[model samples]
Target: AFVAALIAGEKAAFHEWEAAPYFEGCLPVEVMAERGPETLRHGPLKPFGLTDPHAPERKPYAVVQLRQDNKLGTLFNMVGFQTKLKHGEQLRVFRTIPGLQHAEFARLGGVHRNTFLNSPKLLDASLRLAAMPRLRFSGQITGCEGYVESAAIGLLAGRFAAAERLGEPIALPPATTAHGALLNHITGGHVDAIEAGPRSFQPMNVNFGLFPPLAEGIRRAGAARTLAKKQALSARALGDLEIWIGRHPAAAAE
Candidate 1:
């Protein structure tokens, strides 16, 4: 839904809305922006002096607007005139009008500077640096895209690390389990390696794809059904984890 803003704003996706936004309601932002900065503000955002032209209606110098973009769309994003301008520029230019001059930034404008390593080239199955087995990484830094994906990596890293410290021959979670899928993605998915401080890792949350499906293909169901599936998987995983722990507890009381 917000991808249009994300791209148009360049590094300023969220901040593009500091003032009123442009209209990308029917067209692509890239296409809209090509029409010129004011074109969008006037068209999509044209403050038609319509709200109350006779009542000292304050017309917007120009407008930045937003519109619904998807079928199941419950979200909206700013359209055209995306920029890489400084934070001050947005406040000054966007805030130049009547309604928005004092409009506070809702999401704030900013930039994204992403980095990654060639995980396949440096780490082993447990996410330990092959050259420094004592260290492990989890979360987004490991290269899983979403928040849930990252948390799954953290869970597995903890399990594998605990088992290793206990001096017990370790066994992986059943490949047909939630914990197992997460571990599988991290130990050998799309991650590269961290060349700098091992502490420079990212963060994330968890979800179903991280788990193996239920016996009857339950996860594909709608909202209520998916929620039910997650609850069941959590209970099953916790019980299995306890068993694994009993046989090979963490040596350091972690």
Candidate 2:
């Protein structure tokens, strides 16, 4: 929708009006074409490559190309390829390529629907994510998800907005907490918050997996269990968050 408005030279506000159930073929439009060409070029590829065919330098029956999966040249696979199809089928279809017959895949792609509010223009600094702070969006809608991560957002939004109700200015989290990381991801972690790009603004989920490693030996690390590490971090966050909450009891209560 953003790109469409750009092409027509107008401000536009359009969203996925309706999205139904998901299937291997239905996650995104491009996923279906991998099954066959008749379904492909006429469907997802239709009129997409229709740039002056009269030119010699341009030629494509249907194009699906892969880029190096890493800085090393050991791997490559289909672009936009996401599937639950069996391994035999994947290898047979994908190996037909010139350079990737023996290519190894680190991970196959997949997709899921993520509902989110247009937060930048819609919410106050409190993370309420609405024109009115009384109504706040949370979880996948707020663009944060996970057992503890979602709660951490609530911990902040609850306390920050609660502070507002008690007539104190909203306080933001220090950038060390899981809550803070999620908040940053939603607000500004990539390009400028208002700038546009297709690859820009992918939704994020929180985990220690997302945390940048502490400089090799800069600090003594905690337990090795991934789940335990997240829990330990959560315990510490709740303590600091409670102090913030106490400052604005009413907002946290809300």
Q: Per-model C-alpha lDDT, please?
A: 0.57, 0.55
Say which candidate scores most in lDDT. 1
TM-score each candidate: 0.45, 0.39
Q: How many residue pairs clash in each candidate?
A: 15, 2
Pairs of colliding residues, candidate 2: 162-251, 162-252
| Tens-digit lDDT string for candidate 1 (80-196) | 434554566556555653466566665434333334445655678778888988888877676555556667677778878888999865667655455565566555544334566
Residue-wise lDDT of candidate 2 within 1-254, one digit each (tens)? 21122123211222476343443323333345434435555543344555655885676555555567667876765555554444454555555545667767676544555566655556655676465657765555665655566677677777776777899877686445566667777655443345363333445676565544433332334455555556656665665567554765775566
Assess candidate 2 and give its lDDT.
Answer: 0.55
Compute the lDDT for candidate 1.
0.57
Q: Highest TM-score among the candidates is held by which one?
A: 1
Worst 10 residues of 2 by lDDT: 2-11
- Name the Cα RMSD for model 2: 16.7
